[model samples]
Target: MKKILLLSDTHSFIDEKILKFVKQADEVWHAGDIGNLEVTDTLKKLKPLRAVFGNIDGADARSEFPLDAKFEVEKVTVWMTHIGGYPNKYYKRIRDKIKLNPPKIFISGHSHILKVQYDKKLNLLHLNPGAAGNHGFHKVRTMLRFELDNSEIKNMEIIELDKRG
Candidate 1:
C-alpha cells in the first residue's frame, strides 16, 4: 500500500501546513501550475514526486517536469496533465488520446476548483485537487490524500488549507 498525497496549482507558494502532509505521504503528486522549481524541489526532498508543468509555470519548471505524464503506480494506470478538462469537457487535444487509451485515473489542474468524478463512459476516475497556493481565484486552498493498494484507490481524504485571500 502506498499513501499518496495529491495537489496542484501551487504557483510557487508552499506553507508549513502543506509540508506537514507531505511528510506523512509515501509519495506526492503535483498536477501542475507549480510556478517554480523550488516548490517541487522541496516536495521531492520530502518524498517521491510525480508532476507536470502548468500554463503559469516558466521554463525552469517546465524543464524539470513534462506537460503530460502517463505511468503506472501500484498496478493502477494514471494519466496526468496541467490543463486537462474533466469528463465530457476534456480539452480537445487530450480528448482523442483519452478515447484511444484511457487510464484508470486521470488528473489535472488549473481551474482551482476541487472535483472528483467518475466517468462511466471511459471507466476512469477524474480528480482535480484544486489550488494549494494563494495566487489564484480560488477562495479556499485544498489537497487530496489517498491510498493505492494493489490497484485499488481507497481511503480518500480531502485536506483544505486556509482562505486563499
Candidate 2:
C-alpha cells in the first residue's frame, strides 16, 4: 500500500502543519499555483515530488516540473496535470507510445475547491485536493490523502480547516 499526500493552490504560503501530516507519505503531489520555486523546492526536501505547471506559477515549468506526467507506482498508473479539462490535449502525442492503455488515477487542480469523483464504468478516479492556502474566494485551507492497496484506491479523505478557527 502506498500513502500519498496531495495539495494545491498554496499561492505562496504553506502551512507549517502540512509537514507534520505528510512526513511519512511516499510521495507529495502539488497540483499547481505554488507561486514560487521555493515552494516546490521546499516540498522536495520532504519527499519525492511530482508536480505540474499551474496557471500562475512556474517560469520554467515545462523543463523543470513537466506540464503533465504519467508514471506508475506500486502497480498503479497515475496521470498528473494542473487542470482537469485538457487531458486529450496533453496526451495526444503520447497516446500511441504510452504502454499503459488505461490510467487508474487522474489528479488535477485549477478550481480552488476540493473535489473527488469516481467513474465506475470507466474505472477512473479523479482527485482535486483544492487550495491549501487562501485564494480564489476560498478561505478554508484543505488537503487530501489517498491510500492505495494493490491497484485499488480506497476512498479519498478530504480534510478542511475549520472556518471558525
Candidate 3:
C-alpha cells in the first residue's frame, strides 16, 4: 500500500502544519498554482512528488513540471492537471481527451473548493483537494490523504488545516 498526500494551490505558501502531514505520506501529488518552486522544492525533499504546473505558475515551475501528468500508480490509471474541470463540466481543453480515454482517478485544482465526487458516467473518482495556501478566497485550507494498493483506493481522509489567515 502507498500512502498518498494530495494538495494544491499552495501559492508559495508552506508551513509546519502542512509539513507534518507530508512526512507521513509515501508520496505527494500536487494539482498546481504552486506560485513558486520553493513550495515544491520543500515537498520533493520530503517525499516523491507528482505534479503539474498551474495557470499561476511561472516559467521555472512549468519547466520543472508538466502541464498534464498522466501515469499509473499501484495499477490505477491516473491523470492530473491543474485546471481540469469536474466530470461533465470539464474544462473544454481537456473534455474531448478525457472522454476519449478516461482514467481510474482524475485530479484537478483551481476552484479552491474541496471535492471528492465519483463520476458515474466516466467511471472515475474526481478529486480536488481545495486550496492549501492562504492566497485565495477559500475559508479553510485543506488536503487529502488516501492509500492506493493493488488497484484499490482506500483509507481516504480529508485533512483540514486552520482557517485561512
Candidate 4:
C-alpha cells in the first residue's frame, strides 16, 4: 500500500502546510502549472514526485517534466497532463488519445477547479486538485490525498490551504 499526495497548479508557492502533508505521503504527483522549479525541487527533497509541465511553466520546467505523464502504480494505470479536460468535456487532443487508450485514473489541472468524478464512458476516475497557490481565481486552494493499495484506490482526503489572493 502506498499513500499518495496529489497536487497541482502550485504556481511556485510552497509553504509549511503543504510540506507537512508531503512528509506524510509515500509519493507526490503534480499535475501541472508548477510555475517554477522551486516548487517541485522542494517536494522532491521530501519524497518521490511525478509531474507534468503546464502552459504557464517556462523552459526550465518544460525541460524537466513532460507534457503528458502516463505510468502505473500498484496495478493502476494513471494518465496525467497539464491541460487534460474532464470527462466528456476533455480537451480534444487528450480526448483523442484517451479514446484510443484510457487509464484507470486521469489527472490534470489549469482551470483551478477542484473536481473528483467518475467518467462512465472511459471507465476512469478524473481528479483535478485545483490550484494550491494563491495566484489564481480560486477562492480556496486545495490538494488531494489517497492510498493506492494493490489495485484499490481508497482513503481519499482533501487538503484545503488558506484563501487565495
lDDT of 2 by residue, 1-165 (tens): 888989887777666677765786888988888786777788899889888878887576545887677888778888877765433432454444332464787777888778787646446676788888766767677889878888777657887754412
lDDT of 3 at 55: 95
Output the worst ten-in-a-row residue range by lDDT, candidate 1: 56-65
Off by over 4 Å in 2: 86-101, 162-165
lDDT of 3: 0.96
lDDT (0 to 1) per candidate: 0.94, 0.74, 0.96, 0.93
lDDT by residue (tens digit), candidate 3, 1-165: 899999999999999999999999999999999997999999999999999999999999989999999999999999999999997899999899999999999999999999999999999999999999999999999999999999999998999998997
- Report how far residue 48 has shifted in candidate 2, in Å: 1.0
On lDDT, the stronger of 1 and 3 is 3
Task: Arrange candidates, best TM-score first.
Answer: 3, 1, 4, 2
Q: Between prediction 2 and prediction 4, which has the larger lDDT?
A: 4
Name the better of 1 and 2 by TM-score: 1
Q: Model 1, 1-165: lDDT tens per residue? A: 999999999999999999999999999999999987889999989999999999998988888899999999999999999999999999998999999999999999999999999999999999999999999899999999999999999998889989996
TM-score, predicted candidate 2 vs. hidden true structure: 0.83
Task: Encode model 4's per-residue lDDT on 32-135: one tens digit a residue.
Answer: 99997999999999999999999999999999999999999999999999998899999988878898999999999998999999999989999999989888
Better of 2 and 4 by TM-score: 4
Query: Of the pair 2 and 3, which is ahead by TM-score?
Result: 3
What is the TM-score (0 to 1) of candidate 1?
Answer: 0.98
